[model samples]
Target: MDDIKAMSFETAMKELEAVVGKLEKGDVPLEESIGLYERGAALRAHCDDKLRAAEEKVAKIALGPDGQPSGLTPVDGL
Candidate 1:
């Protein structure tokens, strides 16, 4: 779980994709398949959290004078 907490978005996505591939292959035993399913669920949650955080940052952004939003700013008190 700590490893998952430390995983980056790309890393999580890659692992999730690999898990899908393994599941699709249908060669894993029932027990291993269950374990992989749980791991995939955790990875999905982590990826979703990262996406939500990014979306919140996007939503807080203010448009600049040039009519384009400025780059992400650190959330106050974060």
Candidate 2:
């Protein structure tokens, strides 16, 4: 949980999974569980933001009539 903003989507996702696993086992102390839950929420939000950015980029890909990616078009409001 060191500078989560600097973590890549993959790294954040992996950490989030670990946090969820610990929480699901129901064995962690209350204080630790709360910390883990908060971190998991932050990680989930970061992942969502990354995915949304990816979707926006994908939307800008222009396809030719032959159904192949021709180029990237300028996305509105991007």
Candidate 3:
């Protein structure tokens, strides 16, 4: 099995999309479909985690005009 940890977010997401496309095509045998589904689940989880980490990084606030760094604040009505 490939180590998802060593893969970049783009790679993982691309692989997941490919797997989903294959499954949607309905040409794979049942056994192959099951295997692909399992792999897709792992890749999806990895992609989700990477996205969350990215969102956290994006949400980080730099020092404001006061020159003191501030934590992230939620957007209104989120």
The per-model lDDT (C-alpha) reads 0.92, 0.94, 0.87
Against the true structure, whose TM-score is highest?
2
Candidate 3 residue-wise lDDT, 1-78, digit = tens: 469878899999899999999999999999999999999999998989899878776666566788787767664444
Off by over 4 Å in 1: 70-78
RMSD of each: 3.1, 1.6, 4.9
The clash count for each model shown is 0, 0, 0
Give the poorly placed runs of model 2, Cα more than 4 Å off. none
Give lDDT for model 1. 0.92
What does candidate 2's lDDT look like per residue over 1-78, in tens digits? 567888899999999999999999999999999999999999999899899999999999999999999999988997
TM-score of 1: 0.84
Task: Give the lDDT of residue 19 in candidate 3.
Answer: 99
- Candidate 2 local lDDT, residue 48: 95
Cα lDDT tens digits for candidate 1, 1-78: 779989999999999999999999999999999999999999999999999888888877877889899766666656
lDDT of 1 at 11: 100
